[model samples]
Target: MDLPRTFTIRESEHRIHNPFDERKLADLGAALHLKPGMRMLDLASGSGEMLCSWARDHRLTGTGVDVSTAFTAKARARAAELDVAEQVSFVHGDASGYVSSEPVDVAACIGATWIGGGVAGTIELLRRSLRPGGLMLIGEPFWRKTPPDRETVTACHMGSRDDLFALPGLVAHFGRIGYDQVEMVLADQDSWDRYAAAQWLNTRRWLDQNPEDELAAQMRAELTAAPLQHILYQREYLGWGVFVLMAR
Candidate 1:
């Protein structure tokens, strides 16, 4: 029903939750040329930033679903803060197997494709809620450079080399699944730094405030090791992007 406390603690400060920064997010919204009154369904919608922001900027209405109760509350607050509470709603529940009651103009599963087991299954899940001719958005990671060995792949947090494809290969993947890649916005190293490095600070600050907490030791260890791990492994080998697709 909810995410692990450790995971929520590590990402408590994140608005978008993935590697994307505010500017990249806004740019993606703009690139879509979103029209007012369009409807969107966002699955695994961490903190609901995409839905809330687009509701404000594009005057769209949307629903976001995530399993993290803390993040779901934060998302509602953000909707209110942006004065778009009426345009967007968030549900605290599992996004897996979630299908919209009505078809939407956009169906998205950003950065949490595991909800549907993998890329192909995730696309099938999203398509269930998408109107014919509607767009689908998927945020995923691709290999920036082929890892030299198993150790490097593990360091990048991937179980095996097959877990992700290279950028060009990823585009080809969408095609194989019967969708055309229409647009994409990628994350630079700086964006990766913003997402990964920022967690270190949050963990450190929390550890400082609650040294006696049971999770403090774990947080301390993560804070000590995360930055180097990210800089040396993930930032170099991994690239992330939000891709827009249309049914072919």
Candidate 2:
């Protein structure tokens, strides 16, 4: 019914729930060439930025679902802010087993493939709700190069090197999952900096307010140490991109 307490806290603060800034998300959505009537189902749609913006810009209709109540509220508020509340809905629930009541033109699981255990399983889950020829939008991270050491990978919160694939390998992974490469929008180091660095300030602010909270204390320590770690490891050696795939 909810994500971890730490994430809920972060979402409530409007600090780190959205990974992409508005412009990057707009670019990604534009690449999909949405039409007025197209339907979308965005799993793990944090803050519903993608859905709300697309609905406003392209006149698309959709439902966005996430486990975070804080994000769901933000998403709904965003829809209203954008004057697109009639075109989209936000549901606070687990996205892993969610299926659209009607077939959709696109189905997406962005930055949360773990919902279905991994890329392959998540693709299968999304496909069930997609109409024939519907696009699948998968937001994923790929290594810019193979991690030189376990310590480097660990800093990115990865358990092991095998948990990630290099950029080319990730594309091939889609092929292995029976999807064809269509289009992609990659995130550069600057974008990653924006995403990762912003969290530091958010966590710092939270720590200022709730110094005694255990989760905040751990996150504070982690956030404090993350920038140097990212600059040294992830920023120097890894990359991330959101890929669009079609069933082959």
Among all candidates shown, the one with the greatest lDDT: 1
Tens digit of per-residue lDDT, candidate 2, span 191-233 = 7888777767777778888888878667876776878998898
- Give residue 15's error in model 2 in angstroms: 7.8
Residue-wise lDDT of candidate 1 within 1-248, one digit each (tens)?
A: 89987888888899979999999999999999999999999999989999999999999999999999999999999999999999999999989978999999999999999999989999999999999999999999999999999988998989999999999999999999899999999999999999998788778778878999999888888788888889889999999999999999
Q: What are the clashing pairs of model 2?
A: none
TM-score of each prediction: 0.98, 0.95
Q: Sum up the clashes in candidate 2.
A: 0
Model 1 C-alpha RMSD to native: 0.8
Question: Over 4 Å off in model 2, which ranges?
Answer: 10-19
Residue 80 displacement in candidate 2 (angstroms): 0.7
User: lDDT of each model, Cα atoms only?
Assistant: 0.94, 0.84
Q: Quote the positional error of residue 63 for candidate 2 in Å.
A: 0.3
The lDDT, on a scale of 0 to 1, for candidate 1 is 0.94
For model 2 the TM-score comes to 0.95
Poorest 10 consecutive residues of model 1 by lDDT? 197-206
